[model samples]
Target: MFISPPFIFEIDLYREVLLFGDGGQSGKVGLWRVWVRFYFCSSGVSIFYVGREFWDERVQVCWEGGGTPLERGILRLASLFYALGLEARKETYRLGLKEASRLPAPVVSVGNITLGGTGKTPMVAWLAEGFRDRGLKVAIVSRGYGRKDEGRTLVVSRGRGPLVSPRQGGDEPLMLAKKLSGVMVVVAARRVEGARLAVEELGAELVLLDDGFQHWALNRDLDLVLVSGEEGLGNGRLFPAGPLREPLRALKRAHFLVVTKRENPSLRRLLASEAPQAEIFEAPMEGEKLWSPLGGELLPLGKLKGAKVGAFAGIADPCSFFALLEGYGAEVVEKVTFPDHHFYRRGDLEVLRGLIPRVDLVVTTEKDWVRLEGLDLGFSPWVLKVVIRPSPRLLDRVLERLGMEV
Candidate 1:
């Protein structure tokens, strides 16, 4: 018996028939029922089960012949080492072996304990805009992840305007530069350099650090850590084994914790216990609007109902973007996910190109749209604008910390 590798066949057995044409042999595929099983194999290969309602069963089965179990075991062992390394690094900073530099301007670090999709960028933008509105010269300093050149810091935007393209400044920084007109955005690997540049050269009064939780080298006045409600500390284990970059105890370092995407009272209670000293708040990160990437025409969210849509995202959590579209009443028939911060080329869009004719609309997040410029995908792509709706109390608290009026 020839067993194929893991594959998902999302079929509507009742309404749709699988018909093979030409080189492919014709056949009528039939399934009596859908089986959902978690088969743990010594050698694990993950197989995702799909049925009439593909969303109902999101679990993956591990077959023994694929060596998934051993791989998982190895990763768990590696996570232990990863935890140890993190502890050592923290100890070095704690013992004054490594020093944290302070910038002249007040710095606010927005980061996450887990990896990506935490809405740190949106939070940074929100804070920057808030400070700017209060007449503070704000600058957003990002690590400029996925930049083509690894050498030297680039000033993405000065108070005047953007100085570099997304290719030079990185996607997130570029997006921030465009969104916030007056706010300066600087990109550097060593955040200390970026922060210093923003303060000294850009004459920024405030600096917002993007993805700064792990960057212990630069001290911040306020440490605002964001946690995703949907993918809350996945598996709750350390890296390689789970999604956590550090242990749960690391929450103690946060001055404030803002749960993004949705409100979870249970998660808030748990975080409060973990970081008693920190103030917890809820900020739902959501899609605010949709606009045409080509002409800047606004597309009403209500109109998405019953529309056949093709969705693509280069984000840490593509599933969340897909779910967002579905929640907006769009039928996402063709969905594609690229690696986080993926840069798109013409050749990279072959799959999406093939899907354009079938979909009434093609949409992506604003961040992804920035990276997709100059690529002609036959159809104009719509950009979903996402905003973090900060609670009134949360906004007041943040403003209070900044010594600004509520």
Candidate 2:
């Protein structure tokens, strides 16, 4: 009788052993030796598989917590190296090894210290609209995080509307272009070049730099750092271990610190201690209305109350979106999340379609709506339109610093 190995081994090894077993007693002895060798090899492979799964789980724990002592210890060691690299980069900038280029026009940067979204885009849109309302020609310069073309600057909008698709201009820049009429949007890997183009070529009087806190290559007149009220600094560790892009000390460089998406007195006190010189303000992301992207029609926020909805988002902080929907009395029978700035695929649409039978409607964020413009999703999804309502005091202070009338 032929005996199988106790543990799973390579198919080729099994076949070879089975073939050799047909040769009789001598062959059976040889087959037993091969089986023993294959068993040890299989054990090693099993150990490797378990180790990899453990590593992956630990990485997730680094973001969301709840890890064993061994897992945490391993990730902490990794975080130390990450911190060393960050410090080295900061030291270079501090010693003037890397010089920042200045733009002719005044530049205002809206950024965050955390990895995920913290209403920076809304703040930029608010500032751009404010500047436009005050009779200033403003331009928005972005790195265009996921754009196809990064070597050269791509003009998303020339003050009228978006000229390029989301693939070329990036989802954020393209969304900005679509929302803000008469605001020029430019995207480049090098923000300095993008800002230069906005000021010199586009005839922009002021430049609003989106996600510019870490972009040390360009010098700005104002640095506004946004902090998410929901996820305050995450695990409080730097990248690979936590959500923080920079150390808490980086807040010292911020001219203004805006706490977004609700109020937190504890966070306010912490901000005051971290950067006493920086002006701190709370700007909640208020739900404005439900907008139909296909028909360009707007409905009141109350329409979502008690409605059975399928909610999905491709933003950095999707849980926040889900909570927002629930806040409006949405049943939220189905919730889906994709990577930040994710362009929808056919499979993604199919998933949404699967939810259609159970849900009365589908809802998504305005940022995600831009990426879905040309796609046929079988049904139109209502976009949750959110706006950052900065206090008059904050707006007054910002305008005053910029030498503009409120």
Candidate 3:
């Protein structure tokens, strides 16, 4: 029956579509990041291009079962590359220490061990605020995954609202800007340069590394790792096989670990064994979808419980968005998963109108909603904003770090 794996995404699909060319592919950077971050295996020494969106679906799907000889050949090649990419990720992490030693800043990395969609933006916001509240000037440095232009170090500041738009500053930096105002949020492809900009120009006393668990460069002080509750580590493979960026043994680099969702004692024990010196904590995403830029209105999350929702998200874990919606008691009638950091074009907005049915409400992640601002989403969509509710011990640990009374 070819029942697909439950948790991990099917990389073979991506590989087949991406590597083969029909000479009609759109060379957009948005798609490129998606490939490099998750897929794209190394050819023992170099990496291969497996970008699909440009390929025909019928030809691409043929590799799954029924396809001509040529189509099947492409599919087999993709599978080989898919397996090779997993090996490459492990190789990269293995050699990271030498490369990471080059950056001078004492980086305090706040990242998740897994790939894609952890509550990193909020946690970075929390750490930035905590440091700010403690009277220490803080700066945030990120890779700026989906900004309009590349190689620019953007400083996120408030003028109208919280974020500076995903097109302008990427989703994470924009979210950080909105959540922690008066704090510096800098985005640059070069992590070291971003760190320097935050330290020198922004007058930042402490540097917070966003999604830097594997970014060995710009170094770190105390590694704060976030692990999601649902499917904690996935199939626990390196890449195509699973979701881990590095091996479980890599947890030793972390001084403090925060598990998102529940306080799983068993997982904590597992992590403790891996990282004996580190302290484990817990947190869950908890925030009301009260504020929406579409309308200057604050609505309670409870009000939308029985509402039929047309949900859309451009996140690593789109299912998480749906699960959260169902958990909140809202009936998700339809869901549209866009590529992560998906820069919405005029055509996309038109397409979404068809995919999602008219419902009592429209729900979106804060990150997804931020990107939609530049586009004329005339229909004021209700945003389901989430916050990280720290475990009791976790809260205490943060408070202690900031010298604040809990």
State the lDDT of candidate 2 residue by residue for 52-165, as single tens digits. 111334566757877777777776786686677556655666799866789889999998888778998999998888888888899999878656664568899997888999
Candidate no. 2 TM-score: 0.84
* Total clashes for model 3: 9
Question: Which candidate number maximizes lDDT?
Answer: 2
Candidate 1 lands at a TM-score of 0.82
Worst 10 residues of 2 by lDDT: 43-52
**lDDT of candidate 1 over 1-406, digit per residue (tens):** 1223433222222222111111012212222433222211111222222212332122111111223677667767877877676676667678998677888778888989986588888888888888888788999988786677634688988866678878888888888988898999998867788889999988998889888777777888888899998877677777656667778987898989999998888888889999999999888977778899788799788878999998988877888889988999999987776656777654345445545667888889988988988777666889888888886676567668867663
Task: Name the best candidate (by TM-score).
Answer: 2
lDDT measured at residue 115 in model 2 versus the true structure, 0 to 100: 77
Per-model TM values vs. the true structure: 0.82, 0.84, 0.74
Segments of candidate 2 deviating more than 4 angstroms: 1-60
Which residue pairs come into collision in candidate 1? 41-64, 43-64, 43-67, 44-67, 44-68
Residue 321 in model 1: lDDT: 89
| Candidate 3 structure quality by residue, lDDT tens digits, 31-90 | 222221122222122222222244434442552355577766665565455555534544
lDDT (C-alpha, whole model) for all candidates: 0.73, 0.77, 0.64
